[model samples]
Target: METGIRSLRRRWAAPLAALAAWTAAALPVAAIAAQNTITIVVASSPGTGPDILARTVSQQWAAKSGTAAVVDNRPGASGNIGADHVARSRPDGSTLLMAATTFATNAAVNRTLPYDPVKDFAPIALLGTGTLALAVPPSFPAETLKQFVARAKAAPGTINYGSPGNGTPQHLAMELFKQEAHIDLFHVPFKSAGGAVNDLAGGHVSAMIVPLHTIQPLVQGGKLRVLAVMSAERAPSMPQVPTFREEGYDQVQVDVWYGLLAPAGTPDAVVRKLNAEANEALKNKDVVASLAKVGIEPAGGTPARMADTLALELKRWPPVVRAANITAD
Candidate 1:
């Protein structure tokens, strides 16, 4: 009996030893997870606003955390594809989504999505929010919101405006303008905001409501005219331009935002670490200056605040879309 017991113990010893060693190795790796790679996926093409913000902020995160960070661009389907991808990713801090205002707006309108914007994603922080500038070519007849409204009202369907895509912030912005000012105009869609702004500068489109940073140079170069801004207050970069609210069109107020999010079920420790890194990134002076150059202001806040903001926007866009009869292609 003693010989048999010794044989059995010898057979089990190797397997048990291997299991112990594996667990020991994994514990250190898991404990040091704060230094792991954090991947941020943006739902737009490179050089776009979100893409720029993600890359810029990621550099700061990497510097602060002493780890490499990646920014992936997955542009298409009005941000649904990328958003869905992040939502379905492992609930690890390694996979994150750099969500913009579209997350809430999409949720407001779309009845079918692969994942729940609110439930399937954990909000990390609100990075920044800024307004879109409504610009027309220098050759166009309007230079102010009232003038533009007058032109559209006088010409009706003859007036044409361009947007990044249907149901986008730019699209809804102009739609809100139409509804508030009670004017009829034709809609022109482009693949991207830069494209629309380019066409607007070239006089292919009558007007465009694009991110302020994109057309700031053109506006200064006498190639484009900024009729009005869509923020509640004037953009600091262009304080001379009046806001829609100041122009007596408070209903025309619309602003875009960028935020950070991880897949749902991410460990609280990982989420807190990421949130700390992100907040530090936002506070970096270089990041602040870069954001300001693009008319973006850093807005670092708790996950709960971002979630609240998303919920508010989710509640806001449906009625607007229904009223404007906006549809996705």
Candidate 2:
């Protein structure tokens, strides 16, 4: 009887010990995931579209997951400073980076970036997408895209067009338009899009390729006239404005995008977790309403899709930068 009892105990003990080990390992992982405070670093200034989106999403992300999420702005070197900080952070999902089209643009223009654009970060999700508008001052004679092109062809590099600044997405989009249309309109780089809009309203500049959100009010108020939009399709906010494709400018598509990323070594589970949270926030009624007010269309998708966007843009913009010789500094 004693020998039989010992044999049964030894047989059961191994399985019990295995279960115990698993529990011990899993409990700490659960605790760490729950305890870590997520810091979402926005590589842009306060009140910008990306900053606003980060705050809005984090508000709900924290509420849903019971995890603390915060936004920190580190705006400089055209957002490279903040992004680099996150790149070098531990890949524990506690540190994240929110960036816009400038992220890829900076990568395309600068070869000496501190972080590898592809290898140093893992994409979480694509936050949103927006477009730039081709607007002329109210008094400018060109009322349509056709007329605008005609005027440009008549005098290459004679008319001055404005953008937020050299090497900005707006500038690059216009450069792409110029290349596609075979027109050489002179560039008038402004310190800010608002300044360019002001000059356009005042008839100081002939035309501008500005963001629809920023210039929408002026277009509605009759301060500026939008001849066309540089999007794949007509923007919902400005359906009245035809797309460049409608006028046979196929290569003029320039859609500005925003995305989230974590350090390269961040676990795949964490990336999926963040992506799921972002997609959920995008579907929330409140999030949709707020983003609409900013004239931004929410875009949430797989990390792979976001990665593909970055890869495509990196391929698309380098040639344009070289051709335009654009330098922000």
Question: How well is each residue in 161-237 modelled by candidate 1, as lDDT tens digits?
Answer: 99878888788778878888888989999987778888899999998888888787887898998878888887777
Error of 2 at 190 (Å): 2.0
TM-score of each: 0.87, 0.89
**CA lDDT for candidate 2:** 0.86
lDDT of each: 0.83, 0.86
lDDT of candidate 2 at residue 324, scale 0 to 100: 83
Displacement of residue 254 (Cα, Å) in model 1 is 1.4
RMSD of each: 4.5, 6.6
Model 1: number of backbone collisions: 0
For model 2 the local lDDT of residue 304 reads 97
Give the distance in Å from residue 241's predicted Cα in candidate 1 to where it truly belongs.
Answer: 1.3
Please write out the lDDT profile of model 2 over residues 152-254, one tens digit for every residue. 9998889899877777888888899998989999898888767888998899999888878988788889999999888898998878889999999988888
Q: Evaluate residue 101 in candidate 1 and report its C-alpha lDDT on the 0 to 100 scale.
A: 84
Clashing pairs in 1: none
